[model samples]
Target: MGNGGAKFKFLSFSGKFRVLHLTWLAFFVSFLVWFNHAPLLLVIQEQLALNDQQVKTLLILNVALTIPARILVGMLVDSYGPRLIYSILLLITGGLCFFFSLATSFEALALARFLLGFAGAGFVIGIRMISEWFPARQLGLAEGIYKGLGNIGSAMAAVSLPVLALWFGGDDGWRYATGITGIIAIVYAGIYYIGVRDTPAGSTYFKPNKSGGLEVTSKLDFVLYLLINIPMYGALALLAWKVEQLELISFNVLLGIWAALVLLYLFQCRKIYSVNTDVFQGAVNRLQRYKFKQVMILSLAYAATFGSELAVVSMLPMFFKTTFAVPVALAGVLGACFAAVDMASCPSGGWISDRFGRKRSLAVLLAGAALGFALLSTITSEWPIAIAVAAMMGSSFFLGSAAGCVFAMVPLIRRSLTGQIAGIVGAYGNIGAVMFLTVFSFVETSTFFMVIGATIAVAAAAAMLLDEPADTMIEVLPDGTVQSVAMH
Candidate 1:
């Protein structure tokens, strides 16, 4: 890590940087394809002659599958490896894009968009991939670069898709714009599959000993795992409520969804039992006893950090427009500053965690984020627009940093289960989004900020329970001998 004297060359394609660039590009394209319809939503609305509620349904469906998809993909990536999973997902993304583009009815579009949430799972896969390639010392920085730079794809989609549509011209221009993203996915999936490796040659790619659910070390952890999973299902239930209220789906379907979520929750409990049943019989070794509460803590922290990011990013444009009484276009530009700052600030957060300490960095960042959001709550019509924008940017710095810093701790906990850990933590982000947005629907903009601000403060308090990562963690190599990796 002291190799700062030798500038870390990003252009080198030989080692970790190659994997970082390739994987981030994969994440980048996934986000772009996932959000491709967003920029073109207006055109689609006009073409399909859809009502406002239906358009909102499309937005809801865009993220509906992601919470569960990340969990499923995490298991698959840990089992099969990211190279295969990512390539497969990208190919499917291509097909979904094509399907959405050719939709002749709202059902087809909604179906395509819902299925396209699978693309969001790509982020989890690349997290596993990057963690596999980079050591803990460089992990935060590497992940920050991957995610922060990758997140730009959404902004790029916003900026470029509309222009692409205009350039293509005619009513079908949106279709072509959407289809081009699909084509990119199809082509890149091939390249990624052919080029990427699960791990550096001769290095064992560790897999969890049991496959169905995350392995927990103790009975209490088992209970903690089950308790934590409740919110994910609740998030799905909330989504069903939103869609049902819009009359996008029948009440019978909503009932069926609730039943299915209950069944899935029970099934997950069984899986948690099936995987960690030995914990009830025997004591786990201290070397192996990574805290399940760590996951719980990180989940809450992520819900505050990334969850708030998703909710706030979605709301910022409207919030700014309404509060400032500015042009919609100008508000959009201002809103975009949140994401624009992410490229630098996210890396800064990770760097701060790496240099200072993960627990301290996250705690400070979360507290800062809470304060930033609290300040945002104080913003009023009487306030100058520039002052308000500065407060928003200040929050973004903390929010972006907290997002990057969260993953900085993930790889060091346990190498084999990083994907699953990442998955659950990532799922909470979506859960947080659903929860925050659901509450936002019932409250004012200022109330929304206060709610998030309070939630983050609560998460920060919980974060105090997080123990710093130890000097080393043990992972079983493919040869069955445990290998020790440095944590700090």
Candidate 2:
């Protein structure tokens, strides 16, 4: 239904191409809004006279909801189509952005920041949308390009929003600058809703039969699935604990939230069993069911790669300033080089996976990442800045490439469940970020790097377990019509 031969082919002429462009544009806008506060946060801190703890609290609040949001959004995307779900998300997120911009008090800003976490759900929708449009042979590279390009939204915010605030040129300049990005988000919401479809006009858009849980194929897989779900909720509980430590909420409130999360877990498990009732009824052939192990492997892989990348990037500026003895401004540029590598390597990694073998490419990249982070931990201020830069580049290259490798396998697992699969995998990246950052908070910087390096080594070994995608996957569409899709 889509193009042939090239995984990185441009989708400019096809209707699917338009959908891809518009959908990614929508995602890009969501991200731009999502991170608009980051670069401008310093300005905000001065304006509001926030203590360092309050500033840290705001940063924590920004991503706190995203862990659960991704999981819930994945469920919603599979149950509803991307068109309606994505559009509403954009609208609501834009409103939150506007609210944040207009906030005059710390409390108002905090609430607005929390609501903005929903925008992080944007990634899940496009994973499913791109999977629907592209075939298996190209899914890895296609999804990689979509994710890589859209992810640049954070970089865009870092580079542009600060300048925008300066150009606006007043005490209130930041507000106007952020508000403009919000307006762009609102406008794009309408554009995407009208411009995109879940699939081609004649192509069937498959949905899971049950609304609340992931469908599993076996008792063992179901148990594994439940185990995988734990980290998702545990990540949420971790965030609640963070809020409590920051005194943002009371201990009792945190406990109540934790209890509610437990109940939610039970309800979700019930749904998993209900939807996967067929698993116990019939003995399905191996090829007929997706491997739960694959999901686990990719989850760990992303936790190490994208997860570590997120953690490193968060602490990068400070790492560079302290380790290399550079000025704050200079250190920021050096830090960016680490992230800038993603611009090229991320897409390249996907292309490599599509052309080379998926597992081989991932294994090779993860090995490089393990080595890169290990080298990073060995650096000292006495070393040349060039040497440090080289090390950071090495780390970023593998991280970006490994991200490409992880997603290359995401869509291949379950065609109809691509959103949920990508969601869970994506959530792991966020979890990695939180876990790695928390470790960084307690340990020396060198130890933090070494710990992440060790984590990547274990993940690299797991990469060996990933099987290259098979030739075809059979999906029963909504009308109970069977279809076989090609895999590379």
Clashes of each: 0, 0
TM-score for candidate 1, residues paired by index: 0.97
The TM-scores of all predictions, comma-separated, are 0.97, 0.95
**Candidate 2 per-residue C-alpha lDDT over 1-488 given as tens digits, one digit per residue, 9 for 90 to 100:** 35445534475656666777777787888889889999998899999888777787788888878877888898888888888889989888988888999999888888888889888889988888887877666776677777888888888998899899999988898998889888888898998888888887677777776666777777789889989989888877887788789887899999999999999999888888887888889876565677888999999999888888888888898988988678999988888888888877877888888778889999899999999989999899888989889888978888899889888788888777777887889889899888898899799988999999999999989889877787887777667677776654
| Model 2: CA > 4 A from native | 5-8, 11-13, 285-287
Clashing pairs in 1: none
Candidate 1 wrongly placed segments (more than 4 Å): 1-7, 477-480
Span of 10 residues, lowest total lDDT, candidate 1 = 1-10
Q: Could you say which candidate leads in TM-score?
A: 1
